[model samples]
Target: MATAPLKRWVKPEIYPLFLAVGTAVGLCGFAMARNLAANPDVRINKEDRAAGVLENYDEGKRYHDHAVRRYVSDAKPEIMPGINKYFSSSK
Candidate 1:
């Protein structure tokens, strides 16, 4: 018995129409999201603000320095041998 050709969910001729529609929808959604982000009235929560500040401004330098010092002094030298090298200095 010969095998029959598989049917497509969307016809080849109409697939471009679907592609165009999907592209337009995606672009519209992206524009809307961008506008929302740009809006000044958007209120970010305190935790998010704190995290963002810490991440963007390197406010955790003190804690990180303390942690690195503590790790170097207190942690076993054999474990994580070269890991300290990465956090040894900050540019």
Candidate 2:
């Protein structure tokens, strides 16, 4: 038995029309969302922020400062004591 040709669901020329319609719809939706968000009546505030909890920026900054001081500013000799000639003050 011979295999039958597959039926075409959408025409090639209609693809551009679909794309244009989809883009216009997406742009309309985006504009609507922006306007709605800017509206004071529906505008969200820090009380209703997107994230459940805000991170503590100061805590992170303090940790970074401490790490820098401990690891970089007060760095200790890593090599064995006998081979620490380069870091030795007497050298």
Candidate 3:
């Protein structure tokens, strides 16, 4: 019987590379899920649309605006006054 060819040796670093990739993907998925749960109106799932469970365009827009306002206020409360002044001046 003919002997089988020797198996090629793979780099040991490849295992850690796979692990890092998996960790990144997992963290991304978790973050996405958390965001989706926080803002259900911004859903992009096909099933949600087909089942008529998703928000309408206007509702989604309003929700997005609200989220932006919240984020801006939380991250930089000083900016809110400037933003308000700018809008009032524009009007």
Tens-place lDDT per residue, model 1, 19-71, is: 99999999999768855564333336666555542333343444345554876
Over the stretch 1-91, how does candidate 2's per-residue lDDT look in tens digits?
2333223547687789999999999999976885566433343676656555545677455645664376766656565755675567573
Model 3: lDDT of residue 14: 72
Task: Give the lowest summed-lDDT range of ten residues in model 1.
Answer: 52-61
- Comparing 1 and 3 on TM-score, the stronger one: 1
lDDT of model 2 at residue 52? Answer: 59
lDDT of each: 0.61, 0.63, 0.67
Total clashing residue pairs per candidate? Answer: 0, 0, 0
RMSD list, candidates in order: 15.2, 17.1, 11.9
What is the alpha-carbon lDDT for the whole of candidate 2? 0.63
Off by over 4 Å in 3: 1-11, 40-91
User: To one decimal, what is the Cα RMSD in angstroms of model 3 from the true structure?
Assistant: 11.9
How many pairs of residues in model 2 come into backbone collision?
0
Candidate 2 local lDDT, residue 21 = 100
